[model samples]
Target: MRGIRNMVLEILETAFIQRALVTGIAVAVICSAVGFFLVLRRHSLFGDALSHMAFGGIAVGLFTNIYPLWTAIVVSVLAALGMTKLRQSTKVPPDATVAVLLSSGLALGIVLVSISGGFSVDLFSFLFGSILLVSPDEVYIIIGLSAGIMAILLLLYRKFMYIAFDEEQAKVSGLQVSKLNYLFIVLASITVIASIRLVGILLISSLIVIPNITAMLFGKGFRKTAIISGAIAVSSVIAGILISYAANIATGGTIVLVLVMIFLAALVAKKAERTKRLAGIKAEA
Candidate 1:
């Protein structure tokens, strides 16, 4: 315990560590909040698809000598919007669209990288993440975007809830279901892009997904599930960062593993609760 505390204090004294912590917490919060709706709407793979699209975007930016993050945001948002439109207009299943996009994005990224003369260190960072390399400017952008997303969520909570529960009903009730669906895809795209720097392209979806799954094990309502998921995500990031720093492992991988452990723990608790309830019912009978 003493060693852990000392290590944490030592790590905290570094600016890089501070920036990583702030950016990670911000990313975790937004992802958790948005993930609630994503999971409920059965669009969890949407995040995975968009993340790969961000990879292609980054390659485009790199090939053109532009800032990759902005390029990724643009590409991802457009692709997300396109995916939504395709799902609405075509006879294709949403999952099929996502799968097609996922593979296409990865293939595009690889081809672009080849054209750009193969993988560079910068490209590798986006693939696996380098939290220790998070810049102050990126930190600010992450915080700003996260705050904006939270505000939008708060403003449209009821509408979003209705849409998540029943899109057909929401549309019948005069809610702009189509517009809201587009809005959510845009939000998810932004969240995925913002997370890429911290958790990387491959694992960013895990940040958006695992915490929400863990919270759902408790069988809570949507709002409570979101709140709990956000808390769990933030805590896991903090814990994972510290542990990774102390043990010298990959931060993103560590954070994802921590989330998985939390999910397993939740599963055990939920099962125990069910057993207890069933026993109580039997005793009462």
Candidate 2:
């Protein structure tokens, strides 16, 4: 415990740690807000697909000697749009489309890496992430993406919530559910691309989905869910960073591990509370 405390203080004494903490918190909050709708809609796999696709984009950028992030963002957005288009045009389920996109994108990334002679570092970065290397420019980009995500989520809060709770009713209410759905995908695309810098492509979806799952254990209403989820996500990020610093592990993986622990803890606590409530009722009766 003393060593952990000392390490925490040492990390705080460094500028890089401060920046990482801020960046992780920012991305965590962004992911959690989007995640609330994501989990309920069963789009977790879809989000995972986009994260893997972003790997292909990064690989292409590295092979072509261009900024990998541009490719990452463009590929993610276009793929998401394609998913949206296919969903509208065919009876094929969304999961099937995601499967196709995911396999092809992952294959492309592998092929690109193998042909480039050696891209293990790049591949690993996409897979596990390298949050410590986050630069000032990337930090700005993350902040910008965070702002854009928040604005879109806030502006369309009602429509998204409607679709989240009752898609059929939302469709009948003339909510332009299809359009809103596409818009949501676009936002998620941006989010995935941005967060990959902090969380990596492979583990990024966990960052998105876990906090929302944690909140579903305790949150009573939609708004409360978002709030609680965001809080959990932020706490997980903070804990992840501190653990990473103390353990000399990858920040993304550490953060993800922390999130899982949090989810477990929340579930156990909620179950205990419910059990106690039930016992109290029995006693009163």
After superposition on all C-alphas, the RMSD of every candidate to the true structure, in Å, is 1.3, 1.8
Regions of candidate 1 where Cα sits further than 4 Å from its true position: 283-285
Best by lDDT: 1
Structure candidate 2, residue pairs in collision: none
Q: Judging by TM-score against the true structure, name the best candidate.
A: 1
Q: Candidate 1: worst 10 consecutive residues by lDDT?
A: 216-225
lDDT of 1 by residue, 116-225 (tens): 78999999999988888898888899999999998898899899989998989999999998998899888889999989888899998899989998998888887788
Tell me the deviation in Å of residue 269 in model 1: 1.6
Any idea what lDDT model 2 has? 0.86
TM-score of each: 0.96, 0.94
Q: Rate the local accuracy (lDDT) of all candidates.
A: 0.91, 0.86
- Per-model clash counts, in order, read 0, 0
Instruction: Supply the global lDDT for candidate 1.
Output: 0.91
TM-score of 1: 0.96
